[model samples]
Target: MSPVVLFDAALALGVLGCAALALTLRDRTGTVAAFMLTGLLVALSWLRLGAPDVALAEAAIGAGLTGALFLRGARRLGPLRARPPAPAQAAAAALGAAVLSAALLWAFATAPAESLYPPRVAAALEDSGVSNPVTAVLLNFRAWDTLLEIAVLVVALLLVMTLSPPRVIPDKLGALVQPFARIVVPVAVLVAGHLLWQGAEAPGGAFQAGAVLAGAGLALVLGGVRVDRRVLRRALTALALAGLAVFTLAALASQAVTGALLGYPDGQAKAWIIAIEGALTLSIAATLCLLFTGYGRRSAR
Candidate 1:
């Protein structure tokens, strides 16, 4: 047996074990932890399968950010009090999981050899000017997907703002976390910028960069670095709208001048892509920060 094959087989087994443990874990905290572990393991599996981009995504957005969200939710929900599962219910859950797993394994083992769309994507990439097919697909061929994803983010922020109750900062928590925020926020900003720039040809991108920036902003808020409401609100709203507005305008201009939406005039594709990505980076950052902080008026102490 080859070492590569042996390693892949081990990773596959490990992923299955983690999945089963996550499903069967009685404690909510443990379940969340297991899920996070599974995400990390899945990232490793992606690396083993020669998908480094996917591994980066799984590690960052899937494992790190999702785990942070889960931990925060778990904290809000407080300590879990375990309840015994009824035998019949447990049996049914197990049966459902087993059936689902079997179906997934069968599909993986029996799927057809050829993909339906890869060739079409490759054929279109020359016109898009991005060497990476995924990048071309995301930013050029299927730019609409990116546009709609930004819209979904906006809707999510609006929903959170509408649903969250008004909160007054507690003095104790504010005092405790402020010092750490002072040190971390600037570092986070730097990291976000690097990620955004690196995303042009690397694994990092607007979404990941924005999330990191938002994390910093959330830290500042939690630490009671008071925000100027009018400034923050106006700035955030503009940033949130900038990506979509810029992209739409670019697409419309292209259509008028070149006859197709988002179809750049000769030699302008790279410029347009970079411009759109810059706007997207800023917009995504602002939206994520606002969503985390919730809508509120902040005044200096």
Candidate 2:
């Protein structure tokens, strides 16, 4: 156990080191690479602390989605790298960082281990229709919060759609990348399904599953695969809106039966939650892919 503790402590230090390198690195691309590494290390720390769900989220979103976003947007990134500040400015920055870190530590020390929210979630766990407390809380106890979160995604997609034009990824991604993508894309799809299915009982969930699918979609894009514009629009819209539409419909249906929004019928909550998660997985993938690469503008093969 002490050895395990030492390993965890070492991992935490590694995470901090990677984060520092990410922030301080002069090379823009290297900085982004370091950021991705930091995210992976943070995910490992989350696993060490016994939070697989958070670990998965950090890996998928913080490392994967965010890194892809940075690379994708790199086309617009200016060639100018940030210059080092004056010594006085650097000292001010260091002081600000220390203050923030101290404040965070203080807050963590003062905060209770278990709050009222957890007890409520625990009390309702059996009736929440999911064995996993995190899933139950997100989908049952705080379904409205989840709905709002989905809405935020939709708004982001809409904003991106307005700003970005249809994308046509270059077809000449070296021979090695293309061949590797062919194998990876299918496996990622399969893994996404597994994560979605396992979320009901474990750390896997719609967000993680959707992120995996988005990663596959990104690979496909980079491999010169493009769907027709009309086809792409129809499919992406349907897939991206699936979650919001399904959840809203479910809420209305629940209101009719239980006199409350998103209220699942007795003994049928699991099915409802699962269905909602499935649609969300699709929606999230579509939305993310769109944000990364924009709409396809060529003929489908």
Which parts of model 1 are misplaced by more than 4 Å? 18-29, 81-85, 165-187, 296-301
- What digit string (tens of lDDT, one per residue) describes model 2 on residues 52-161? 98889889889988987775555456454666789999999899989999999999999888676767777889998888887887888889999999999999888877
| Residue 293, candidate 2: C-alpha displacement in angstroms | 0.6
**Model 1 per-residue lDDT tens digits across residues 109-195:** 998778769889877767775565666667788887887888888788778767763433434573548678877888988988887
Per-candidate TM-score against the hidden true structure: 0.81, 0.91
Query: What do the candidate models score in CA lDDT, each in turn?
Result: 0.74, 0.84
Best of the candidates, lDDT: 2
lDDT of 1 at 131: 62
Q: Per-residue lDDT for 109 in model 1?
A: 93
Best by TM-score: 2
